[model samples]
Target: MTAGSFLARLHGRTATGVPRWAVRVAYAISLTVLPSGLWRILSVDLRVPLMDAPTDGRPPPDWFGGEWWYVIGLSAVSETLAFLAVGLVCTWGEVWPRWIPWLRGRRVPILAAVIPAGVGATFNTLLWPYSMIMISLGRRVDGGGDLGLGTHGWQVFVFYASYWPLAAWGPLLGILTVHYYRRRKAAESVGVREDGARSPAVTVSH
Candidate 1:
């Protein structure tokens, strides 16, 4: 099967009643994380000069001390976590996957998902905008200004352009989390009513 069809089927099985816009936003969250991940990977893995050069004639700290694998691992971990945002609108967030050993087929506790997502949203909300302003002022226009990534070169401008989208990541995740909570709550209420209706009535004999 083609990749597109495969992804559609995969997403379809997990999510029910998720709004189209929310799913789109989930995808956007993944996209927003890609550029910085790529930049980091390129700089570290390929030994490319994508990052800012050393300031003050002192060498930049060896981010893992020149270990290439560490850089790759960091990038992989980051993108994987970012991709999990899709679960907000997908079925897997509500129901445990069958592949999971003991938890399979169990109804996922709503708060289990909501709390972490909500916390992440709050943290990212505070972090990304400040980050963007710093990048815009420090790197984009300021040529190694103290507030932003302190690298000077044409590459710095490219870096700013690529990483700027990350500023939107926090707000978008916050929006998706709100929608996810509402839909899950509504579904939970409906499930509770269904269970109540199906329950057998008890009769007492005197």
Candidate 2:
């Protein structure tokens, strides 16, 4: 394709640039994280293991500051991530939300999201290796526990069973991020810039 058309196509092709595999991965990861986020919010138990010391294959009883407080904190973080997932689907990632007041409905610069998301996806993909290291060798810096269910045979088993979901998340996000970038480059080749670039208009997906 000519440079102009190639760039022009970015606006439309962005949707496609995000591969089906990545889309499904984003959906799966977001879905799994959503329930976990909700559970973290509603549950009274924090169940977050303390990483004050190195793990001994068993969590320290007092690792979490406390069950309830820990749960609340964990819930907030999970919900934040869940909300961020909307960026993957919506142009809001390209603009500030109306609820945001002063910057409400303002266009988000591409650099803002791409730089972070691209880098984030890169590192996030690295998590697979980290996870493998944790399982095979162990962690060097103690911080927190993986979001496994509990310290029971079934709990561990289920943790493993569901854990595979996250593995898919990173690669999928990488694909999506790459797709977004290429599409953006193409859009630049054309004339369609983001909302704030010239006008304050916003475009919603059909």
Candidate 3:
């Protein structure tokens, strides 16, 4: 009869750990830092060489054949995806949008959400290794005295070092992913057939 009882019986799962707000904040932090690193790459700025050549009087890197816009645009998009992950933790993923025409107040399916997000979060976690490879093999270079941070061997290590928050992206998402699947599957099984027999619903229309 109570709210807690209803949720427990309905969802068949316990909602625990990583408060919704904390997840949202985590996503926000990840989203911000990600863009900075991404802008450099998309601008082809990542390979600009962090320590500088020490010979030429060059002024950072402005040369990438004017295709710099691609970097700017894409970085924005990638970061947006990171931001989206935050919504899953909050109720927004379900029914918060009121500005949109058809999408406003619509329910998002758990499976529809979990698969892509679980995959993306896992992939994002892979950045640590990828970044390491890029740094060691001279791939993800940050470039110049303008970067404000040192570009030495130990300094170059910071690229991966600062990735703690990002690394948490997957496991945190994984917990939500599991919670969603359990809740959704429970919803499916609790439905009834029209023929007066008990049966699971084929499709959830939210």
Tens digit of per-residue lDDT, candidate 1, span 60-108: 4454447878777877876777787888877677778779899987877
Ranking by TM-score: 1, 2, 3
Q: What's the C-alpha lDDT at position 98 in model 2?
A: 68
Per-model CA lDDT versus the true structure: 0.73, 0.52, 0.53
* Model 1 worst lDDT run, 10 consecutive residues: 192-201
Q: What lDDT tens digits, residue by residue, belong to model 3 across residues 49-151? A: 5434434665454433446666666667766676666555445554435677887667666666788977976776576445444445554434222333325
Candidate 3 backbone overlaps, count: 2
**Candidate 3 local accuracy as lDDT?**
0.53
The best candidate by TM-score is: 1
The predicted structure with the larger TM-score, 1 or 2, is 1
TM per candidate: 0.78, 0.59, 0.54
Q: What is the descending lDDT order?
A: 1, 3, 2
Residue 25 error, candidate 1, Å = 0.7
List where candidate 1 sits over 4 angstroms from the true fold: 2-4, 9-14, 51-65, 139-153, 192-206
